[model samples]
Target: MTELAIGHVTTDCAHAADLAGFYAALLDRSVDPGATEFFATVGRESGAHPVLMFIQVPDRTAGKNSIHLDLHAPDVAAEVARAIGLGAKHVADFAEYGAVWTTLADPEGNLFDIGTGQA
Candidate 1:
């Protein structure tokens, strides 16, 4: 038998370094020093899996991705505001099933969600 685990969540963008930097600032994680303009990663300090990797794709698809990230914050409003300040665009907000979530697009237009409740 073999065991597997998720390692990285990679995104394709026009500028890898820029996208990686934006996420690094948003997550308070540092971009790996060995990063290059074509490829970059913002890694976790305590573990190896779940590193956020960005790769340059000059003609990458523009719009919401099929798989989007979901984030949780103590205060959804404030976090969404902060994400906007970091270059994210607020797309919309939804409330259902006793949970409310805000949709936002990253600089390159990759949509993600943020909510107060567990997703």
Candidate 2:
């Protein structure tokens, strides 16, 4: 038998409140009240289980991000433009191994890729 289970993923952020809010707006979900400085979860019970945790880290993001999220978009090109207008900047142009994808970074320098379908 094959059983698949892994713990949730959390991203470290400098400000819990600010980063939580950023994710809330980006994900279009309300922030979980249980969220604190050490942790936060978006879409807590909506099946996304996508939690963006904020831990008190001294370092501000500099250079390339070691970890990043890949957000699926209905329209990769349009979403890339929209995200850029919303303060996200293009880190790299569109590229693909088998699907379309674009690399972008948030205002806080967290890197994420937006794409349509599967890559």
Global lDDT of each candidate: 0.87, 0.73
Candidate 2 stretches greater than 4 Å from native: 1-4, 34-38, 45-47, 60-62
Report lDDT (Cα) of residue 74, candidate 1: 89
Go through the candidates in order and give the clash count of each.
0, 0
lDDT of 2 by residue, 1-119 (tens): 86965445566677666667666777677777777765667765565654556665777667777888888988788878887876788988675678878888887778888888686
Candidate 2, poorest ten consecutive residues by summed lDDT: 44-53
Q: Which 10 successive residues of model 1 have the least lDDT summed?
A: 41-50
Candidate 1 residue 11 Cα shift, in angstroms, is 0.1
Distance (Å) between predicted and true CA of 39, model 1?
0.3
